[model samples]
Target: MTDTSDQLPVPQRIPSGIAGLDRILHGGFLKGGSYLIMGPPGAGKTILGNQLCFNNVAAGGRAIYLTLLAETNSRMLANIQNFSYFTLTPIADTLSYLSGYSVLEQEGLEGLTALLRSEVRSHRATLLVIDGIVTAEQAAPTVQEWKKFLYDLNVAAEILGCATFLLMQFEEGPASQPEQTMADGLIELKVRSVNMRSIRELQVRKFRGSAFLEGGHNFAITQEGIVVHPRAEAVLAVSPAELPKPLATTEQPMRMGVGITHLDEMLRGGLPSSSTTLLLGASGTGKTLLGCHFLTQGIMQGQKALYFGFNETPAQLMRKMTRFNLDASRFVAAGQLELLWQPPVQDLLDVLAERLLNAIQRLRVKCLFIDGIGGFQRTMASTERLDLFLTALFTALRTLDITTVCSVELPDLFSPTVTLPQTISGTTAMVENILLLRYVELHSQLYRLISIMKMRESGYDPAIREFRITDHGIEVASTFASAEAILTGIARFSTVTPGVPPAFETSARPLQEQQS
Candidate 1:
């Protein structure tokens, strides 16, 4: 065996060519360090290895991808060509593939080692990737021979100044004998199905020379290739330019008409532009109706809008809204409104974010509404995952300066109110405004109430307004006066002393009493 440490000193950091992944490694991979990538079938282990080599070659460095299990070079080239960095001649020159299946199947470790050594020198390879170590191991007649082969391969990689990558498929337990011990670094790719949706995660089990980002991180497989999300950097210092400037007290208020004049007046115009608003209420509280009105108004003003409905199908939602006299078909036919009715099994937040991005790009969407958050939460088994998804979604949407409205369901109005579940509190806390809708009882009758809970950038009436869902959609009646505990979804008449007469008293009782 050769002295591995004395072979070649580590080179400077090499770019992974993946933006987010590079950040996780604090820059990029160690230039000349050999690493092991272990995962199950279809974990994207080979694709990641190919991406590393492709990135290096694209940046003027030489790389070689040696395959052991498969010899489909043409298919590999075609698959990789989809990426923006892929080039035919340059890639062919800089990147070469030597298959071990041919040599190992024909002769053994002696022939395999001979072929690898020849390719290492002839190709002038700087980066060496072993497609499947299992194939090489299976070809070896004995365990001792397999160990010797890996040791020789490592020594060859060291002497040649090539950064090596060994691909291994691991089962439930740890990797078998010499393979795990011989590797300098280890990365495990895990794909788990959570709530019937597949989530890809990556864990750096070991890194010899440098520290790595601890724990697993979310990743996605896009048409471009595998993209990993980098760990969020902490903000320490901020310049004066980074600090938000105070808004002028006399700034003109921008409005988004809700397609109802009375509702607009109640909102002192309508919803604000470039802000996140939440419509909170229980079932039958006109939350969907309000969101529909917002989208319809945006369409009328020539600004496109997108509505993401998780609970109801598009047809069902349209039919229901028609009963309230909202003609959504006009906006739909005009291509100004995009309605996305997704099943609860789907990741609604991801779908919503994707559609929002597309709409903003194609239609210059000014308003985006996620009809109800409850349906989204029900699909996600864990609150932490839901929160993480929403945080990423909201951050992306907020950066586009798109007016966003998220409707949330209230199971019990009297329950201690929270903007969102504990898992997603970080997301809900960032919302700029909240519109609270509730059903109240007054004079033995149930009446609908609307109150602005919070508005960050604009002034809004604090008083609760009486509203009803009618044939013309939601219309605000007169503002309630001398009312206390209105937010509790209940109201009572103010007490009058013996000598004092009541300001207003109806001889007829309300609908609640009639129903009773």
Candidate 2:
């Protein structure tokens, strides 16, 4: 037999234990490499170092943390006390922290390099973190000497199969540093203020052995250390699973009801299943009510459902359901239905998407109702990411076969300018269906009109209908074809009667009698 013992084992990764961060790092830091973490003061560098040490120990690996700057040990440990990863451990066997300022003072850079090598080998450490690396740079006699010290430390680390991090303080400024090119990976953290709101972001400039997400991802230093939220477009660039196959019929796929009897007929059966639908309307146009009906109908049909809203709390929503005789609290309590309500406040876009997707999977949901998608736009720090964000979000929804309905509030109650609303224009092309609800002026009175604007693939009735929200939920009446320019929300009829209703408004008017 041939000798087969010469093969080397493949290197593994060291997880940071920060939620949603490993994905951005492309499965965390690769073992046997050195990384540089640069940021200003109070940017969570110390928190990250301790968090990584505890994570490595929890994974059955040893770690050594060396600090060169001046700080009391109690104050450093105080910041990491709240997180679960900061549990006390046997210092000799697991995680060990020691001050290296004396070694660097007495013997200089060469002595520090030897000290790091000695400590790592003695502890059998798989992970190492050198906090306050800038002190070493300032102590070096020359820039070339600093670079040499880094090269020696990195080589020793790789040979010993240990992943290393050098934490350095840096003010927000330009990049062109000498040490940046020498490290195997470089990560930068920043806190920027936009419109009086602070946004914390992380960016990975370079990685040697892995391909990482390239963008400024949002991060927060909560009680659980540092939690990063990767950009949605980058993380979900491709759908997690394949989308459902199309139906055999020509342009006709599966259809699900919109909860109203006559509206389903107007929809030529119902909205397309596993499709994204947008409800375009202004405030008080029954958008939330219509979404409630959609979720109620799905729950009644024994399909799991989710209602994610920013404006309404669970108590408020349950009260509205009671008004329509649709009691959903029972299903909600049974875990068949879930209500995910985030208050209208500043939030990370990718964080919301993470919660949305996780809830869908938790409930095995089939129908989804987003009460006000424009709420997300209002809370976002960057407006340019709207198009790509929604496209990726809806693509992931389709991959899970979720029939989604989103309510978008138009700026005006009635207008004829033919302009897309700034909040929703980026999402029009991403959805499969569009339904319009607007107030049309007729006979000195405002009447609401509902119409199907577009059905991308399915065939449907294009007639404009008058819809009413009564004590019995949404009721769709006959088509309002007697007036021209009804779509403009300023209807014009040939009849001159001011008080009397038009003939088309009469309930006795036959559906066949209306304009085809």
Candidate 3:
């Protein structure tokens, strides 16, 4: 016989016609093979199938689109032309569409098979598409009929040696039929919600005889068709390069002055640059005012700073700061300070990351302040809310070599038996410094007490200091000594016995004699 092996036609590789998608597929679908596309309703199943048919014809291979639910060829063409791809006249002319079977009628599957066979032979078709097999299933009178029709159709397409694509609508639960088992390849489209926003994902569930990407990737549909953004984990196999060496001057630790001279002295100069500082206090305890002082001082030192306000608008914030004698309008007008007032309502991680990146680029900021962390609690899951947000925020701020200050409202300031939730208090230990602000009773009057609870990599004064908000901003008053419970937000004094000597003399005497 003539050399039969040499007579076999070479297989063709048809392009998916989607620029980004084609890159992921390593070219496109293979000729003389079958594939299945599974997704829920409104997942753009029909549109993707139509693009495949049109693209094949444009590349010099004939295509036949067999639709069970869609309308006639003219209607399909008119609808798809709205997309820019209508200019491909060659594909438009060579493409053939067939759809007239009623799924409700028992003749739907039979009619499709007859039409498919005829079109395959007449056009010598290299590619075939079944717009939807689910439509046929819905039309069948009984489950038995549906199973038979699906099995027969699968065999017919395989025997014809035409590269076929079957579009199926998947239900919410598991796949009931063996359709997925029979197909050579299966692509699944899924939708998921992140922070109340829907995200589209595509996963290659199965692809026989080919090394395919296994995980899901993000994608979007636009007027030009479907576009897929490959997951970072999929393409970036090598680790990133180590960070660049810091400038000679930056290698020496810098001080982030606390905006007030007395506070800086209490902190032993100031907070370290590139460090995270936690300011803990109750509501209306001047936490925001302290943060504003930090930002204003940073701007004055020629370093750009950012202030994120969760509770006030930019205009309102500026007006409020003016009352504290810190004019913020000058720094804003000078492009040295940026005020981001809105609390992110979307994926807090994504929104915060994006905004921080933008601020670093636009303002060249060196310091950042989050007015309060409570606003972000609702945006993330409870278990990971605190740690995840803190880690991400810390990492981003560190990348810019920026000092970050975060203020948090404490539930209880002095209850010895009360313990804060792990999510709320755990992040405090992660910072380089912790500043505690409390309302203390001194001389039978309530005064603000400021103390440095923790200071890493530096020494700080641990004694509580009295402070007040004055016309010139926050000013520290002289410290006082008392033998009463004054730091617990209340002041009470006990009467000294007549026989009790001075505190110094009582220590020198015996315990029995002092008690007597």
Candidate 4:
């Protein structure tokens, strides 16, 4: 008797049966509550609602999908048959698809509410989806009548403990309609033009009684229905305090070779394991070859590896690697290596990040080579979120203990000194190491030169060394100590001793010859 009647009921969550969607909702929608889904035509409102209904019904709860459009039931079935979720048993038995258009036109809003109440009771349905709520709004004589009808429907749904969905046709931004006020949650779908391509996004405008993921999450309508790709920054944001404590500083960090002895020596042993490295180079400067060497070295060390190629297909990359005598197909067949080829064709950055992370986790990838960061950037519509995206991505990699090397093509090869492009989203600071590969003209010959520009963890050799790609692998030649302008894309003898030939020219001989 202690004010029990005034107690608020516990909110129950109903899973949408969609992985990312449930996470966005912080679980799922509140059960026994009416929600509104607003979107423009062809914005996937109907598909989303239908997916939820079918998923609920499949989980042993009955559902009623009432469409206010005048389309025939057979046509609706045919239209939905293409989706992978559509099944004959659920459609014929567990779920009921009814038309509310005739009821609204003939009997008006009150009749529509009565029909919903009767159907909910008869079917013993826990889920109710009213598609094309715009028709009922139009059929009502006044705004007050529509509000009354919405209130009555909500009451009826609440009485039956049925989670309800009202799909409304919205062309633009959020509207201040009475139905929205009456609903417990509001979901909006949008289609926007990005770089001449349309991208579908979903947002939760309001969700009562629960904390939800805000902002827009990209989605797509595939044969499996709606799949949401939550932005990594929003989904995986973690505070530094949340990260696990590191080991004692006295314990030396592990390192891995880059498949070249001299390069490893310059790196003070080798690259620090689990560190992120940026390979800044121009085209034809052996960036891809360097990445191949990294992956092959990992494979040789019995570590799993992943090569995410943006500009080349798996077959193409493997064929290219054959020239270096690195046969990746064996490791690929052994399940120790994964070659993922994704071209920059209307790809979403969030989707790419999710896919890469998933692969890394599933494959237990210890070494990762992302060939062509520039190609990945081409897929993004805006660079504004790139910094946050990179932060989240690198944090995840470090947490997973994956050593990553991403190759970014320099815009101009003829520049005197290398500079991180202003267009790059401040990702340089996040990288633990920076290796600059450039084309330099020395003695009327274009040669590849590499220099360790920065190493965060420890000191590294700052010498500009000549490198050559051979049939076996990449080999580092003698340092360009005689060439003062090595990094200026133009080179000349720094100090000449008349009797001594150029050090690089003499040292550019075969490895065996130099050894001899």
Candidate 5:
């Protein structure tokens, strides 16, 4: 039989040399296709185009960078000199930089197309970058002439087996542009001002034959070039079945102790490895202390841990933990723990997620603690993305088999509601366990109460227990036998019939007996 597979030619792709951008493109740009890069004057379109050219030439492909703007070649080269990727010698030999301004002025669109064709063929270039299409549009007296020029340019590129990038100053949206219709792909870069701060974003408006991540991803202009950070919500790769096997012994299912004896008894032993728990409470309700206990437990067990303190500085966290007799400094000094403290305001969610994932992989961390999840919501531009972002993050941690504890603060300190705050609603569905800490007022005295609200695939104590932060550490009492409505912030005893036992009698036992 004839081999029909040989009749189909292999598809070709060109790497943009930007890791995140390539990922957003679902691989890379299709080879031998024309793409349009549009943005405002200072949106880094020219820089992106040039960076692609340099990266392609470095990969054994010749490229031409032709500019039709008033900016001179020397000025452009000098501007790019500071970038790490801008190499002088290789750019001089392999890549060609030519000015199309004079040609467009002398012979109009026809001469510009002819010049592009001549240079692409003479240099045997596989990539061509036209850096000033807006100027070319100004030169075209009629719309038909502009369309003809674009058609000619595309035909020339296809015939010569060259991939073309047309960079233009797009002041407005490109929804109605005829040039957009002709190009095989369109990439848009934008700089938006929010509360007096600039945020750079990139979007793939069109990729004719390929599926790309369809969203505005955050990007930044660094010393190297434009680096894109894809939104975590758009990319969900984590799942329990895909989790890496535990690095330690595989003889039994791994579990991490919660560090509190009574809490462990309530949890039936401890949290399962790779599970995520959310500690929901109000301010000054021992959430941070609980997270410290979890991390300290992991460190004591010889497992690496990471702590992302969203609101507290490292020193502040150390001082606070010291009050509870937990010394995080020693573990940090020994490199068994990583403590990162970034102010939540003006922060990008994707950037934080990236840093967290990188730390988990680099440290091979098995335990993670995020203090101030309520403050984490302040970092996002919109509250709607918080759920998706947290879901993706927890999934990624689960895939790495990292047990995590995140603390979220409620709005009303005295309210008895157990739901998440408005800013971070719907995140409870992603959590494998939920612990609620609340303030209780009994007999004109303020006390702390703890409850295991929910536990997936496991049984937990259903009674509300009173806890105290002593000089040594947190001490958990058995269920509050003296109160009936302790969780409502107002505690009182329930009346009972003379012949029957009180309701609190069976609901709680002594701490010593419960632990045993």
Candidate 6:
């Protein structure tokens, strides 16, 4: 038999009271791990250090926040006193704050080590944070001395069974830093500027004795503290076919109607269940009202819905819905539909994704209408990652069995061809169905036309139809002439023979079920 006495079952973890943080850290920090948190000034290093101490002490465990040649303890506390996490009562018992500048100056490395050991052991600290640790590096006259001090701190922290965090200002090529090699993990925070906006992001460069999610993740410093928003692509990895069919309120079905009888007919009875659809249109082309129809139809089926819009406030959307007699207030009052309006402002892509997903889970929503999907492009970290980001988002929604309809803005109607941003051109495949809504110039009047561009999993009507937005909402034409019908259609794409005119088909095409 193997000698398993020294082999522990699993490493214990220290929970950091940060939202979405433990998930990225693979269940928080290893109990005896030593981590280096490095970032530039105003990058949230001091706040994170103090917040972690507060979190650890709140859980009945002791924590120590030590500083060497840095701001005094009272000043540090004053800075973070306004945060909600600050507790005045706990500081007397479970938490300890001290200055190590005197010991470091008097006895150098050995004296500093002795002070740390004595304080941590006396308080029985489970967590330790050293703020402004960069001072120690500069005080050391040689590289070897600095390396030894870091090595000693790591060894002592492990011996005391304390998870320690060493906070310092951002350094150039941090991977080459001495503490990086000695510490058990490295976390770097940055505020990156792109165009006129600045985004805060975090990356776990290294984590020992456990597996952590790699790559950069966005974070925000709020009143409570730092909140991490991991990339959706890394968190939601289920492929389309692999996702389970969703409808938490009812048994799985094949199709759901969009509330418009004619549009449903064009969609082969209704849109496919648990599928994503893109409603592409120019401004004032009735795309938003069409999306409202999708949401209302979902509520009629006993499914909850969400209308997430960027440009329009909830009041504006509610007014528009009322104008079309959608009973928007009743649905809202009954909790059948929710309107989440987030302006196109200082928001990160990952942050938006996390919030949307959380709302879906909270309300058990089955239908979602993302009014103006193009709004997401405004804050994407990079245009190239949009495809992956959208793919992951769609995958997560599908896995939850939610049916989503997203609207994209096209150029002005008078333009010969609508040109979309180059970034959005590649995301066409991310959605299951594609619908086109355009305004047609016919006989000095603008006629609204709707067409099914593509349906990956189902067959749909290929012919275009004229639709009108009445006070009662959308109404699609029922019939077309059979005399070379599709060839005329006001002559834009329809080819008219020199002597012949385009006639319409009067009969309806038989609709079929989606592919099983």
Q: Tell how far residue 484 is off in model 3, in angstroms.
A: 9.3
Please provide, for model 1 over 454-482, each residue's C-alpha lDDT reduced to its tens digit, 9 standing for 90 to 100.
Answer: 88776777876656554566656444442
For model 6, give the 10-residue run with minimal summed lDDT: 507-516
The true-versus-predicted C-alpha distance at residue 341 of model 6, in Å, is: 0.8
Q: Which candidate is the best by TM-score?
A: 2
Off by over 4 Å in 5: 1-4, 171-176, 237-254, 482-516
TM-score of model 3 vs. true structure: 0.59
User: Which stretches in model 2 have alpha-carbon errors above 4 Å?
Assistant: 1-9, 171-176, 239-251, 481-516
Q: How accurate is candidate 2 locally (lDDT)?
A: 0.81
- For candidate 2, write residues 1-516 as lDDT tens digits: 756787666658888777577988878898989999988888888988888898888888999989998985667777678886778764656888888899999999999999999999999999999999999999999989998999998999999989999999865565656678889999988888999988999999898988889988999988778889998889778743466666776556778788888788888878888999999888888898899888878887778999999998989988888887677788788887788898877788888888888888888999999988877787689877877888888888888788999998888877854356675677898899999988665445566678888898787888878765656677676555532344443544333244332344433222222221
TM-score of each model, in listed order: 0.66, 0.90, 0.59, 0.89, 0.87, 0.89
lDDT of 6: 0.82
Overall lDDT per candidate, in order of appearance: 0.71, 0.81, 0.69, 0.81, 0.82, 0.82
* Per-residue alpha-carbon lDDT of candidate 6 for residues 361-426, written as tens digits (9 for 90 to 100): 899999999998777877787878888888888878887889999999887775546576677787
RMSD of each: 8.6, 5.0, 11.3, 4.6, 6.2, 6.5
The residue-by-residue lDDT of candidate 5 on 384-455, one tens digit each, is 888778888888878777899999988767765665687667878878899999876545556567889888
Error of 3 at 293 (Å): 1.1
Cα deviation of 322 in candidate 6 (Å)?
2.2
Model 1, residue 473: displacement in angstroms? 0.6
Q: Put down candidate 3 lDDT per residue, 330-427, tens digits, no spaces.
A: 87888888899765554433344455567777888898888877766654433454665566566556656888898888887544333445676667
Looking at candidate 4, the ten consecutive residues that score lowest on lDDT are 507-516
